[model samples]
Target: MPAVTVDSTLELPRVPVPPAEGTRQRPVLSVTTAPRGFEGEGFPVHRAFAGVAQRDLDPFIHMDQMGEVEYAPGEPKGTPWHPHRGFETVTYMIDGEFEHADSHGGGGRITDGATQWMTAGSGILHIETPPEHLVLSGGLFHGIQLWVNLPRANKWNPPRYQSIEGGQATLLSSPDGGALVRLIAGDVAGHRGPGSTFTPITMIHATLRPGAQLVLPWRADFNALVYSLSGRGSVGEQGRPMEASQLAVLGGGDALSVAASARPDERTPDFDVLILGGRPIREPVAHYGPFVMNTREELVQAFEDFQAGKMGAIPAGKMPHTAPGEQRPV
Candidate 1:
C-alpha cells in the first residue's frame, strides 16, 4: 500500500478545505465489490470496475488491481506480448517492480510507487514482466492498471509513453494532516502530477490514518469514483461504508470526501484508496478484447492490422514466454 509516502503529512502542501457554502458534496451512488480474477501470465487481480455501468465510467474503460499478494521465490509473473489500441494503460507499482517495453521504443522499469503510462493510440505491441532478478527472488507485488479511453477524435493519435518515477508524484495533505495524497496525474487544488494524458483525468492514491477524513475539490465536469484499495473506510460525507476491494460510484458534485474508520484491519494498518475521475467522452464505445474503438468495424480493422504486423514488430530476439519461474537461474 506504500505507493508513495512522506515522513510527515504536516510538511506537505495542504489541500484547502472545500467551502461549506455553494459547494455540493459528492454522494456515493453505488458501492460494488471487485471480483477476484487472474491476469497476465496467471497473476491474481481484482476486476475493480466490474459491474459498474460503462456510461458512469465514461472516458475510462477498464481497471485491474493487480496483486496485493506476496509471491515466493520464482513465483512472480507478468503478461506476455500483447496488443492494444485506442486507449492508454496507466500502471502504478505500489510495492514491487515491473518492466515494460513496447514496440514503439517506449520502455522502462518501474517500482516502489513509480508509474508507467503507455498510450496505445492507433496500435502497438508490448510486454510487462518482472525483471529477471525479481523473478529469480520473488517478493511483494501490488499495483493498479487503469485503461483510459481516448475520444473518437484522438483514437488514432500517435502512441506515447511516460515513465513517472515515484518521487515525481505531487504530494499533498488534507487540511488536518491526517491524510496523504499522492497525485499521480492531472490537477488537484491546482497541483499537477507528472503523467500526461490524451484525455483530461485525475488519478490519486490517498492514505488516511484511522478516523481521518479528506475532502477534495473536484471538477464539476468530470465523473468521480472512489475505489478502496485496503482497509476500512467510508465514501461521501454521508458515510457510506466501504471496505477493501470495493468501488464507489459518486454522483455529480463540486467536491468529494472519504474517511477512514476508527478501527482498521491489522493487516493493512490504514485506509488506502484510489480516487479517479475524467471528463466524459460520451461516445459510442465499441470495445472488444484489446481494442477500444468507436465501432465494431474499427475493432475488426485493429485485429487485422495487428495480425498483419502493422502495429510494430517485436524487437529482435524477443519471444513470448511464461516467466523466469519456468526457467530458473542455475
Candidate 2:
C-alpha cells in the first residue's frame, strides 16, 4: 500500500507506539490507501475516494470516506461486494443512501444521512452497495465506512447491527461558540450519544462555526484520531485546516483539543469532524481479509469455516434472536 498524502503543507506528528524504547515524538505518517482498493492502478494513488489510516495516528487501521462527492444515475456508482471479519465496520452517511447485504444473514438499506454499525465477529461475509433511492434522484450519494478492531476477548464474539437514523443521533450545543456536536457512541463534555457499543468507545460528530475554536476531551491510554469531513481550525496553537474530504491526523494532548469557530462576524464555513477513540488492544492484531484475531491458527479457522458455508459470524452455541419469519430452510 502506498502512503496517501494528506497535504504537504500539513506537517507530520506521531506519538510512540507501545513497548517502544521510551516516550518519543516521531514524524507524522502520511495518509495511504490499501493495495486492493487501488483497482490495479499504479502507485502515487489518486484522491477521488480515499480512506485514510488512523492506524498509526492512534490504533485505527482504516478510515475510508466513501462518498465525499455526489453521483449521477446510471453512473456506475456503488461499492461492489466484499468481506469483513475481526473488526467492527461503521457506515455513516450524510447526503445519499447506501445499500448493504451479507453472507452473514444481515441485509438492509440505509437512506441518506443514516448510519449502520456492523460488528464482523467470528467469521462473517458481506457486501455493500448504493441504495435505489439515489438512483431515482440521480443526485449525490455520500457516506463514510470505518473499521474498528475488537479486544482480544471479544474479537470472535458475534456479529451484530446497530442502525442509527439521521434523526436518532443526539445533537447538542457546544460549551463555546455554540458549535453543534453529535455524539454517536460515548459522552462528550456532558452530551451523550444514543449509539450502542460493545467496547469502551467514543465516536462524535462536530460542526464548528467560522473562527470558533472548540476542544473535545479524550483518554490518554486510549487511541483517538479526528477525520476532517469539512471546515478549518487550529489544533492546539498549530494552524491546521480541516477541509471537506480531507483528514487531520492529530497529535499532542492528554485530551484531544480542536478548534472550529465562526470568524469574528464572518460567515461560518461548513466544518465537520469525526472524533473516534477507544481502549487500544495491546495484543497483536492478525488481520487477513476481514477476520482479526490473535494468531494465524484463528485466521485459518475463520477461512475454513467460511469455505464450509457457515451462514453467520457469531460464535458457536450463541445465536442472537431474529425477527419472526426470518428463519428459513438452510
Candidate 3:
C-alpha cells in the first residue's frame, strides 16, 4: 500500500454514537500528569497512563492529550521530533498539519483528521515537525498522539506503519440529532475503523447533541476511559458532568456500559469526546522510556545491547539514544 498524505481542504469524518440501554454507571473523570521523572512537553498529560489502567488497558498504554494549541511563529514549540520502541505511536490530526520522517524509509505529511499509525518494533528514530502553514501563519495545531503497547508476543516483530488520511474514514450520523461520530480504529455502526489493527481495540470520536442520551457497552474485561476533548457530559450512571480536559474512568466487568445526557442550558457547543479503551494485558510490563519488556532481565539485556550497538546506533546528535535499529536507505 502507498502512504496517504493530507491536504488542506480535507474533511474528517463526524460519526455520532447511539443511545445504549441499561441503567449504566457513571465514569470518574480524573486529571493526571506524566510521572515525576520525565520532563518534556509531553509530560503531566491530562489523564491516566500507568495508573488505574496500567496493566488493565493493554494494547493501549497512554494518550498524550496533544494540541488544540495555537502556536505563535517561532514560539517555544511548534512541532517536535521524538523516538520510540516496543509500541505503536498513532497520531490523529484535527487541525494544523504535521510532517514526519523516520529511519524506516517512511516519510509523509498529513493534515487535520488524518490518522498516522507507526509501530516502533525493535526501535526507531524520527522527527515530527508541524507544517509552517498552520504554525507560522498562526492557526490551531490540534490532535492526539496515543501510545499503544505491542503485546509481549508482537513487540520485536518489526517496525512498520499504516495510515488513513481525511478520506476513507467513516462518518455516521446520530440516530436523532445532527451530531456525528468518527472511528479512528475498531468497529462502530457496522463500519470497522479504517486500515487494520494489531490488537482488538476500538477508538471512537464522538459529539453530544443537546439533551442527547447515549449509552454504550464497555468490555468488563477491557479497561476503558472517555476523554473529553470539548464539551460537557457525565459518564455512565454515576451522575456528574465531566467538562473539557478531563478523563472519565470505567472499570472492566464481564461487560461495561456508559450512559450520558447533554445538559440543555450548557453553553458548550457540541461536546466532543475521544473514547479509548481496550482488552487488558495481564503480563508483566518492564517499561523504561520507549522500550517495554516482559521481564526485568530482558529489559537489562536490552539496555546493554543498545549501548553495545546491538539494535543499532543512534543518529549523530540525538540525546539519550533511544533508537537502536537500522534505518532503511533513503
Query: lDDT (CA) for every model shown?
Result: 0.90, 0.56, 0.59
Q: Which stretches of candidate 2 lie over 4 Å from their true place?
A: 1-59, 261-268, 311-330
Per residue, candidate 3 scores C-alpha lDDT tens digits across 1-330 of 011222311253323343454424434545333332222433222433535556445667766665555666653232233446677878787666777666566657867678888888776656666555654566566677788877788878788888788666665544454445566777654577785667677887766565654455445545677777766666665655666666666654332323335453364555677788666666778777656778888777666655554554444543222333432210
Candidate 1 lDDT by residue in tens digits, 93-135: 9999988888888898989999899999998888888988988
Query: For candidate 2, what is the lDDT?
Result: 0.56
- How many Å off is the CA of 164 in candidate 1? 0.5
Of 1 and 3, the candidate ranking higher by lDDT: 1
TM-score of each: 0.96, 0.72, 0.77
Greater lDDT among 2 and 3 belongs to 3
Candidate 2 structure quality by residue, lDDT tens digits, 121-198: 765655555555555656655556667777778877777877887667666554443356666777665556677766
Q: List the candidate 3 regions with Cα displacement exceeding 4 Å.
A: 1-53, 76-81, 218-221, 253-268, 304-330
